[model samples]
Target: MSGYPDNPSGHMSGSARTRRADAQRNRERILQAARELVHEPGELKLHTVAKACGIGQGTLYRHFPTREDLLAEVYRREVEDLVAAAPRLLETHPPLDALAAWFDRVAAYARVKRDIFAAVEAATWQDLAAHSLGPIGAAVELLLAAGRSAGGVRADAEARDVIILISWLSRLDDTELDARGPRLLSILVNGLRAHHRD
Candidate 1:
């Protein structure tokens, strides 16, 4: 053999692995900071997010080259997370209860989306929504399917209809949401009961 250590696995060097892990941690931190900052009043500033995350602006830019890039990433991750929640919710709760819980999650997502829209251009917002529709619809369908199978939701209930019904949640002001959101969701859940007209 040559005057070198034997190499088998092609794994990265320890320093390289540490750098990769740090970059991933930084990306997550940036996302978390952006998510919170987007909800604050006025336009979102990249520098503010960098400051919040305790990273330099250049570091932030390396990860997200533009403001739109950062916002879109935040939006995409939120949609991904929301879609992933459906199956998890069903695992621990009854179908109808899981559906209700998912509705609440959707409301929270709506609030984040509202803030994202304010920060992003109309075109960017449209693009984000277009990409998000499929996954979000699938999540809703998953929850509905579980409920229907359990005889808790009406057989005729469609995911599209359920989406339309809850669309109003996005329009509610903070005050109205706090005052009426839970009651409205309760009525919605009750209305979707299997016994409700086919």
Candidate 2:
């Protein structure tokens, strides 16, 4: 017997699933276009992104009300991707190494997620809640806790501080990051240095 008043597909048509699949495909395509634009610095155009996505201008407009909206979606999904990686990294690497590896991933995002992130930082809570953003703070707490408990990270550090670093990092151009990242990251690692007991 079925658990509901109707079978699983009773209320829905084949068209519904097809539509959902189409929507997902479009979202993926949009994200890919966004990635390309982010990597290319200031050369992005609406038509270029749409051409890369293989979607029409009308379709892109139907999905994203404005460039800001598209940018926001990219950042939201980027955070979702980051949040989802923690468990898999934990399984494959020691806590400290996992944290370090994740930092590398973040550096990549810092490079690519730049255009989208500025829009996100400007977002108010009400503006953001429309999109059902996930809880990044919890994800941060979990990862940082792992690093701290592994006896390889600073006990005094918190994820909030890391959040600030990442937020600022994405705003830099490659020239700036190439000039500054090594020294700043070295300082960061040194700050994470744990105290040795006698």
Q: Give the winner by lDDT.
A: 1
Per-candidate Cα lDDT values, in order, are: 0.90, 0.70
Q: What residue pairs are clashing in model 2? A: none
TM-score of 1: 0.91
- Residue 85 CA displacement from its true place in model 1, Å: 0.4
Stretches of candidate 2 above 4 Å error?
A: 1-11, 41-43, 117-134
- What are the per-model numbers of colliding residue pairs? 0, 0
* Every model's TM-score: 0.91, 0.76
